[model samples]
Target: MTTAVAPPLLEDTQLGPKAGGFYRYQNIWTGLGFGIFLGFVAWLVSHATVQGSNWGTDMVVTCTMVAWVVGFNIGMGTFNAPIHWILGHDQTHEDELYAAGVGQGSSRYLKFCTDHKVVGTQYLVLVMVLFGVGGTLAMMIRTQLITPHSSFLDPQTYNAIVTIHGMVMIIATIIMVSGPFANFIMPIMIGAKDMAFPRLNAMSFWVVVSAVPCLLATFFLGGVNAGWTTYAPLSVQAPAAMDAFAMTIITFVVSVTVAGVNTIVTVVTMRAKGMTMGRLPIFTWGTVVGGALGLYAMPAFLAVMTMMITDRATGTSFFVPEVGGSQWLYENIFWIMGHPEVYVILLPPVAAVLEIASTFARKPVFGYKVAIAGFVAIAALSIMVWAHHMFTTGWAPNLAAPFMLTTELISIPTGIIFLCTIGTLWKGSIWTRLPMWFVYLFVWNFIIGGVTGIYLSDVPADQFFHGDMFVTAHFHYTLLGGAMIGATAAVCYWFPKVSGRMLNERVGKVAFWMIAIGIQVTYFGQFWEGFQGMARRIAYYNPHYETANQMSTAGAYLLMAGWLVFLYMMINGWRHGKIAPANPWHAKTLEWKVPTPVPLENFLVDPVVTSDPYTYGEGVPDGQEVPESAPAPEPELVPAGSAPGDQIDAGGAS
Candidate 1:
């Protein structure tokens, strides 16, 4: 009987690679190995072509970059599809994918796990890392600006820091709203077992992961000095690091486009039987619009990057004015995607706030249909308004009014968002929970942001404001103040649901007020500076602007402190906080129908939607349908090798 114990049921870690020869594909070490090996091969060929010349240095860069991308794909098992297809081993392997790394253990956080929840958790971790990196860069910029001259970095180094920070933060914002929420929460809310394309969903996230290291490599190479927009001949003349940035951009675009398609298909094809388009959750609608915008807008920018890279690598001079190409051409193409891309990032976080508002307000979402229509209107108008960014560039005078008008027209749809939030809270049972407080914070911040934006919408105002800090202030208010605030609210509301433990309520509220006040203090000072003739993107400034600059920098530190509190709440809350029930907030949505630490497939089976997604009110009897908050069960990722009720302990000793 002792001999028949069967080696005590080895867990994944215990079942080591010792049994499987050399290649442990699921390991991160495997990927790094592949990247280094491929980079060497590329360098050898590159060295030969540019042998004994200064070009040899840049050749090593270009070769190494290509090698990194390929190696990452291979190491992460992203190439398994092609390998399976080539071998004729029945390429349909969904069964294997569905079962891979299906657990609550931290090990699944690495190595391309196919489970949506696993992927979502991984994304949450990555997004925080990006924010930390970007925030540090921002602090550095602000630190240098605390005086009248550059103290720490040369002008060129400062420009690179700014560029890197801007790109990282932009990418982070895009991921913040859509990546984790859409992949993890949307499927469950819509009553689907998984996204329409599960494997592709996994692939999209993995590729984004692969692109990060490549982008970081830019700092070590001569860093990218051109801004994130990477306009024209300026970008073409940038050092070898610009090549790294271009490759990262292409890789990111491909990842996002894949996500865009996956989200649209999933929403269109995978909803529950009774959940029609009109009955869909507002957040779902946001996801759909965001996805559609990305689908249509990303490819044009991809073309832009390809040409930009072509100009850099082979000197074709596609954007070189010396060769008779125009800088305006690049601006036109980039902003075409650029302006809509802001809306793409903006919409989902707005929707998330709306959804969170309805839940906390204990009322139906006000003007639900109108809000959907408004999202549509904003999407349509966003593409046409890209020319507004070009107003100060001395484009055709005849086009100025039309661009200004289109830019101002965007306010109408944004107004509708304000309408939804205010109307929901008008006469409802408002729980001033940490989440709803941030909703109110958004209302205040976005109003300031939108009104300031209106000032800049006029051609004269934009021309006056364009090269100064006011435009910078306006941009930050919209993206960081609006979208980023809404995104933060989503995290607070959904953190318990995701982690199976409630965040400390007291700490959350304190964090919210600090962050909101900090942003106001920070950006408001910048607004005055902008109006004071303070130039944008410069390390040194006039002494008259120093007081405002000091104010801005101090407030930024406050913002950083607030973020640190949030990080503490999340880390401490995860391990030792109160365990939450399935429906702690007592809301009636399809997602909350399951037990905490939601089941492996979300719903045990596909649920049937019975009515409109927003059913909150005094109308539905208190006890009619929504379940009471129950005690948290011992969490497990489906209780190893047993039936539903047979929950096991962490070490499987029960």
Candidate 2:
């Protein structure tokens, strides 16, 4: 009788003594630490609530709370595991369970692990939930607008709902770029096992989860009446409900910072041996630049929010104009983070669409280097253009010219992204796959969005359009056209890879057309209404605006219906769709090379690259076909305890 061979050890040696078993303990300690810190802060806040003081003490307390939340995560081993490995923890796993092509969902996904894929799904599901909530609020707002002076909701309740809707959408925007797509796809595209700092990754997500309920609590907490900007003097004078808004913003800022740091470190250090900076996928590069902006830009927002909290609670004068503080300071700092924040949300999806188009067209990205350079240019210029939002507010006229020039100049780099998309599609074999179709639509929508942006960038035109429906139309096009479409395309393209099943193509196409048409009907009416002088954020308006409002309300229903269908298709696809083979798209990326369901530790042995990822058609050789050599055929999905890497030649057997 033959003796059974011993299974190879599968410990995460790179993580040192704090590897597998210790995560449980780490979680426990982290929870305890957070509870104690929050308890003390609550005590102080209660005292301030009772005292009714006008001293600047509230600012100090809010700052202390923000510091504690941010600092504890840094201290108690959240981001420590990745840092440990990066600094030289010398253990290695040789077991089949740890190999590439193995597929197992980690406990970390259920808990808070920093795996980009887990964070990506977390962001996707979280954003979807928020989107639903925001949409519901929008329906209520429209009900009020269904007729002039209708009072479908009281002004207070209406304002609260509208404020929450805006805040939810803002948070959603932040995650749309950084969370699902960046976290999930960046590591895969860069050919890394996971994010550079996984624990920090988990920490960032958990922070957001903790903050969200508190934000939603505002509905019951006396309700924030000011819009998402929380413009002070108004915010300061509003009910205690504003406290919840301030707290949520502070928590969100902390979460964004953690994510930003993780992204920057991961891209800088963890690329595959051959994946140089220049060779990085455009989407990954977009994440890098956006992450950099988030890290630096978010602090100003945190500072401003901290000041607002202090003014509200401690009776400070930071933004109370009657108390010698300047309200404009708040506006300046808010937009400082605000405008770049838009780019932060928009850039990744644009980049993702570019990558999807290139892959689907079976061509090299037309201008890979130029595309990356464009992202860089956008990031740098985004900071300068924040003042453009302030143009109608009466800053210097000379300042207006500079802001206008910088704002218009941004279109140049943005135009390059458009050119790259068109070039990739030039005479290419166009497969009308769901993802590709969305990419084509993205190009069309973004072109319209970009051009309309020019009309707003000019100071003279903006003077007439600021705060009008025209402004509303411009942003909806940018946000919905650019960000929403990109996100849908990514979900469609990656559904098979992520879920280990194919989506229903017929249903997906139906969903796409509905959304496309719905968007046009919803926003196209707003442009004419805006040009005719209808204002946003008002519950009552003149009858002259009635026709446009009626049409917009009708379009909103269509938009909601389209999203419902899309959601249905996604759910059905996951549960009932056909089992997918690896590399269903026949693409050359390393992520698609992995086994379906993807193993716990990523790859067993490290991957070695010998072929270019963009080669297609006649350039791809027999036996060396991109899909064949990239992902070896598996007779069946590997079960637990099997050697996933043993079935195929990862780097070709020596």
Candidate 3:
């Protein structure tokens, strides 16, 4: 058999500004202008061609959004490389460097730069914007619930706010950890220079950028009133805005699929010499698993969304019951992606927490292999348990038992992960840093979330809890409380490395307490209302439930205020916080070994992993594995000006 030859690696060259060509004219503003122009042209054509028909408006919107995606990519220089290839031309070394954003300074963040760190930073900003939009909608929702008969928003308006809010937050949380930390931190942790596919990394981010406008455009197009799930019958009946929502999901699936493949491939093939699978960091494992699960789950979302748009635009009967389509089919396909998505949002942050716990507690992670097993089991069982979400639908009564059993069984591995966290923190002298504080918050909040989830997982108990404020409170505990909390900790933990500055610990702590207390007050109020038999998704409620609703609303305002403060802290810290040195936390991970404001290739010399990263405490040799119960006297701090992996032949920047 003939052997395949690999392409030669490019020699390192100092990157400079663009060499004056077509790319100089391309950026996000250019992309926006092109997209808008194309969308308007498509709208004019579709309106001129079709009028006074059931699918007329939907066809216009769908065609317009498609045109926008294509036009935006064209204007962003996304098609330049491929077009060059088709004409027997290739990007020179300088073109590649320019695309990687070497000397462009701040403007690179707005362009289609391929640097993984730049993409990660872009995802961070995107997450904030999404949360800002979703949080505003949340405030509107809580405002409406403040009084029993409040007409703060009309029914259709309230439903639209809830629909967009659910979807925006879901998308934001799914990418919160994986988008930022997975891209910025994971490559360094694995000793890779960059992702296995860097151009795809940049494309993944810019594609999501194109999709966000489509989601926001939904409101102007009369809103998607079918909720975030966009369940059948209602979705099929929704106005043209539903077309925009479907386009957003379809576009987002491309981003997730591309990003997932890059993450998995980077970890699998691009890992540094000697960085064997067993020696890989916990966060690396967490990110890879999350990426893989997202790949497994997103296809269903893509399929359902495609079918949804077809039904709306082409007069198909895929989800239209009166036209012989089945609502049960929609629910099945939706939840097939839905339940695993919960883990996709959860795994990265949970793994980050484990990494943080090991660092701050001055100990090795307890049961490292077991934690990996827990992630695997959670992903494996998540797919089998999706039908539990349909217990109340009455579509398949017989499958409920099997679904319920799988749901509860999945909790076993979840408990194991929790136990590992506790075991790691048990006897070590814990450093109560800002990141560690969030870890404590995660433990407390996730316990409540897990226990309440069990109550809802039971078939008999779910009869009361499903579709009430109880389900809302339970999932908020899981997603917002658990996953979001973990993401916050990761931001705090890695902020110094990413930004070259220390976070404002004082203000961060204040925001942390307010948010923690607000979560308790808000969800606890909802929990009480659910127990009192109050239904969900209603603008009007009985007068008797006003007190609880008021409490929930008041607590929601607290959450909003806390997040505003957190946002301010982040911006101010990034702009004005004290300059940091390499390895401020003195952690052993390869990322910490790198400089603050890490360089273009990550390392001047490639990293060769000699041992596991979490070798803390005294008397433990550098490469020796620490067992779950292993302990020693409190480890001495690394002297100022030195870090754990400083001995490696690597370069650093101040």
Candidate 4:
């Protein structure tokens, strides 16, 4: 194996302003500038070739967008380390460049810093922006739906808003937990200093960042009128704005694929010496499984997009009916990846909730093995169930029965997840930390989501609910309730570790109840509208559904209010919240074992495991684990394979 050279210590001597050379390249504006220059150049070249028609402009726009992607990456210096590394060149200074200059202050957040924590923070900020925009788009949708007529936006404008909202939110959901928590916390949990490939880490983060513009670019380009799932024939006929969605997804998938490989390698190879597979923390397990799903699943979406792009730019009849193209081909590839995608969104939060549940419940996670089995089963069964999504299309009617069976069987594993969580809550003096409250909410909301999912798994019930608001509610329950709720829990739980500040508990609770209530109110109202036979993605609705639509819109605004409060809580808490010591919750995970504003190299040396990290209750012994409600022991550098660290590792013994 070619062992990657460890970069220099994360905290390096800062260069003075007088310093020249690579110091000039540390900012993101450089990337933006390069992107614009290249994009304009590409546009000119296209215009020079094509004349008179909009086709010339279309080609120019397409070429410019492609050039900008390259330029943005170039500006970020993403290509620097790779070219040097591949050619056996020295890049020792490249390490210092990422150390983020003299003060290493807030500017690091804007620059391409290689630190996992830095990259993770970047991803967090990115999602916050994306979600905020997506939320605003959603409120518009709800507003227009009120009173069953065109009001806030015209029908075409409404379609564009809906399409943009749907697509951005899907990307947001995919990255919400996985990008932030996994990037920041996983290596820490596995006892590694950084990800297996730090450069790849920065690239993964910035690539996603670079793609954001293209996603939003659809708004001005005649709009992406198709739903988030552009599908075939429809996507083929979509306006030029659809190209932006395709590029956004395609770029995001590349990021996912890159990050996936890096995460898997980190876990498999970088665990603290004795932290065996069985000893791995639940969140680490979640990261690995989620990463694996992304590694395998996202490429399929990329393939679908690539072909779709080709169909547009080259006049290839890939999806055109008259020229021997097949629409089913696109749907098959998309859903094949799509079904596993929910699990990809879901697993990290599931792992996170599982972790929080055990700590706050004052118990070891009940059925750790069963939860692991559940993860395994969910991943194994997820691929087979994609066709359950296709039942409504009637593309392959005969296959529906087998797909339905696999879909229902998935419930057995999911049921195990519920079993483990509920079992942990049983008979324990549950300490409801602000974060843990959301974990419990995740359980409740997910139950509704899951049971409804089972209902939809069957062909007959799906026939009833397929095209309506019921479908929307079901997924919102799962995706929002599962991923978003859990991400909030994780942020609350780990805020201290990330920001070195304690989150305001009362504030979190208020935001939580408001958002949770808003979610239930909004989706359940939509559910009733669905029962009244309301179809989604339309500007106008039937007069019979006015009350429910109005109610749903009101609830939607409420949800938006809650999110604003939540955003306020996060920002205010970070800037002025109380300073927290290392382990505020007294959790026993390896991350909590570290000190505040964690150093570049996570630990002085890697941690080794002697026993499971989640040892609850006394085994009639004095010092077996980091006890509940005990003040955290002060952290210090311990040598690898040495005394104090060994003792610390074994201290969590059962």
Candidate 5:
């Protein structure tokens, strides 16, 4: 197997001077920049609380804070400083460069780095930590739900646990799917060195991280019990915890906005020559569309969260029933962002699954153009379908007809993605590899998830299932099936690429089966329990619901076991598994073309484009095996007025 020659750094005369200036001022500016911004926000909040007449001031301060943060990162050279130092420039010191740890934790991580890979890993870690915390809350809720009318926990505590669980899970879903895989894999797939704006990438992650403490503070400060949605009069009536929740959500929206901008810029501008829109990988296309949705949807969420914060702290009656505040405004704004937010969390992972399936099946992604179109359709359709979630919440009946139509229309594009997956696997030499297994599972799970979604979207059917266990079951199917499964599959598929070691197949398979079965056991019961009239978030549910709840609890054990085993396998693999080849999966992607333990700047020389990634079967040159080595063919170099050093012909034809 041949190793890929790394790509050379592209010189940018226009950017070089600006980059140097920013690097020179980086250390001093980054610390003070964030500090000043935080101080300003604190002051504004304090002022608003005390004086009470300056409603416009809060909006102005928010805009200014966001702008300053974005500009400060750009001014400090967070993104390109590492690249500058690594490319043999001496404007920056070795110590400064080393402190940044190449591209892994650039000083940019303290600010913003435009490297999607770094942002992705940041999201992965962030989401995993939150997932653990969320799961703890879930355990508490489960413990309460285990027995009928038992006082193991008080009603208030139960409410807090349920609320926290829902909020954390929502945040986890948003951050998990797009952050790691999209950040890490998208550039690699499209053959770029880094995201279009590495600084913005870093900013996105830090924005998300900064929000976490605020979220946790909610629990300590009499947590909001209205669940993550924080609906209506109950939300306004909640304690100081509601303030914290609102602030946390606002922070999250900013993070999503930053991420959205970065993703859009990177996908639009950073693709390799010949990697046109039609040629872009399925996952990359998914991220592009998903990021767009996030960009458009997040601003509305930010507005609503700000309005909520005002309602809680400043007594501005956006949702206050008595003071010209319409509760329906909250519902309108929340679902506007909320529904598309679901697709934002989901589509990228679905895209990742498509890429995984194509890679392991040793085939071109079936209907590549069709898949891209599907993603675009899904993005557009996602916005119009938001009211479907609010059908029974007294939205206009006229609204329901349009929303119902749009919601159901989304299935058309969603089905296209499904068709692509099935076609990719049809009559193909499928490798029963760990990644592929997860891909197969994703398809099955997503199918069920999609079908279940139909029932929820139909207004008539949703009227019955609106606030019951059925809603929970539907979401679990959608999230676990579509998002979590796809994310896990991506982890398995790319773990070797990231860590340069092979995970244990046996343990991986064990984890996969347990998770698959466990999910079925856990959520399927919710459907039956919901059908029989069980409400969610009640500490003490009906005794008639006991059997299904017990079964779900039992399934949770299996689920936990599967995750534990998977974690152990990954940790052990990193420590002692066999060193991996550069292209372990024998896939056709630019990332696999690079050496293992990817270099500081990613490539040593710029790669010249040749062919599309998944050009399998007859598309590949006759009698030429898909090289289980590098994505690029060996280049014939024109001697630089001298013979090449120790050129060894590895007995292969060009």
Candidate 6:
């Protein structure tokens, strides 16, 4: 008698055709075209009506940029559901599936696709594009600073590059891990079908896309020379570009709020039946905390930017000191959001690295609850420490003591997180992969960043370093060395599941070493310059500092080339790398159990969790021998565009 074998669940299935009617025709190109058309119309009308008025070019620029966002949304069918509700013809279920990109293939990526995976993919592309722009700008700044009195760019142009690069990198890093992994992998990790609010997920991404043009337009409008901080008095007197900068910030705030809500709701409400809070992956916890912190922090940014707009557009005194407003007031509100937002950029990637460390070390996450408590403590303390940025301002010398105390105190929770990472790696069987290489790099760099930060947190030491290249080096170490490194590890760890192919490890290692060495050389040189009392944000420097500047520039070029190599590897891997198995690392997380090229609804059967997600190493906690069954026979690889043979397994594998 022959025993029948059931078809494997880990196989791709083709989806049906699109069903959203006319909305299916609208995509990114159509949105761009419509946006340009509306912007031109607004420019013409505003130029005639408001150009020579008291508001002048600021009003005209603001009007044009706002129109572009509105038109883009309209053309992208962002208002379709609301419009349908008004017309008494709400979308059918079929339309909802089509809007989710069912069977739309590559075109779905360009459209206002509501599929969380599609949105995640879109975010990944956007992050890369932003990095490319910002890195190019960094190269320009480094080239200009390669020697004292270099004339590669005028002072105004150099300042513009600095402003744009800072904002762009900040924006990119904020969303880097949270954007792709949180939206794509987090849902599956929790054993959920999709995010609770899929349409809002799509909206969060597209809104940010709309803001990019406004930021870029600043260059043509005579540039925002007020730095990324856009301090008052300087920002108040800047050219029309300041208006565009304000619009970008306002738009970004909206995106952050929406994304924050979506992340919270999805994790809180959508986990599988038995996937309790304790069972959820560390990365999921990280994403949720980061999202929650953003909700608390971003509104402050919104308020400050809005007030700045009013100060410029309506001649309000919100930030104008001559009219009863204070520059100290501006600094206070900006840093309120500014400091917490650092954790917003930070927590997600750090969480991701812990997840990676656990997986590659073949061990459960050590002190999981303690790590969660550490994340919470850091978030709580982050908000109270903002005034530390204003320590040198002397707006409140009496308050400085408290702010410094809080700043130093935050490092305790941060240290707990570090201990958890080291504990997880202690005496474990480590599988050193591309991801783990970055993990090791993170430990090395973050120690330097953390140690330097302590000096800055002390008011006496901060007084000497406040405006110097030391402050610049310290931040780059934290943001670039720490957070960005963690994000790179996450991308490598999750690349297979996202792309259905393995990353090119050989090329990736080459890229990794280059970046590792480059970061040290680059930042160490800046640290040397700062120790020599070199001031930051200067186009020209003393001849004595030229050698340090050249060293930093040389290292910057290596960093740029390394990133380019890594980018190429990702592109090549996505197109033609070896096909990845469903559980390439034999990871225990729910996301790994799903098929590579995850299906429309992620799983055919909802996973019912039985234990904590990380059950790595051998045997039970009580030293009991776990029952072992003979391994299932290897399944043949199904060719592209074909379904596997159907056979019965009534109670499906989770």
Model 3 segments beyond 4 Å from truth? Answer: 1-21, 618-654
Each model's TM-score? 0.90, 0.85, 0.93, 0.92, 0.83, 0.92
By lDDT, is 2 or 5 better? 5
Q: Give candidate 6's whole-model lDDT.
A: 0.86
TM-score: which is higher, 1 or 4? 4
Q: How does model 3 fare in lDDT?
A: 0.87
Cα lDDT tens digits, model 2, 1-654, are: 223333232332333342343344444256547644764676476556655545333443444444455445543435545565697853233211222111223444444554566667777888888888888887787778878788688888888987998889878877876788778777876667788766577778777765676578678767889988787788888776776678788889888998998888887777654455555667887888888888768998899988887788777799987889997888889889988988888887888888788789987677776787788999999988888888887756679998899999999999988887887788788877899988977887778788889989998898888888887778877888778788789888888877778889899888888888877877777787797898877888888888888777787788888888988988898899899887888877777777776544455434544443555564544221212222332223223233222332222112
Off by over 4 Å in 2: 1-108, 610-612, 617-654
Report the C-alpha lDDT of model 6 over 295-407, residue by residue, as the tens digit.
99999999999898888887888777889899998999999999999999999999998999999999888888788888999999999999999998878999989998899
Better of 1 and 3 by TM-score: 3
Error of 1 at 390 (Å): 0.8
lDDT of 2 at 371: 80
Q: Where does model 5 exceed 4 Å of error?
A: 1-100, 103-116, 619-654
For model 6 the local lDDT of residue 401 reads 90
State the lDDT of candidate 1 residue by residue for 113-227, as single tens digits: 6667767777777788989999999999989988988578888888898899988998888888788888888877776667877667777887787778878888888888888
- Candidate 3 on 14-120: residue-level lDDT in tens? 54554525677789999999999999999899988887877999999999999999789888877777788798878887887788876678898999888889989
lDDT of 4 by residue, 324-390 (tens): 8888888889999999998998998899899889889878787886788789899889988888888
Segments of candidate 6 deviating more than 4 angstroms? 1-18, 86-88, 618-654
Q: Which consecutive 10 residues in model 1 have the weakest lDDT in total?
A: 645-654
Q: How far does residue 471 in candidate 2 sit from its true spot (Å)?
A: 1.0
Model 5: what TM-score? 0.83
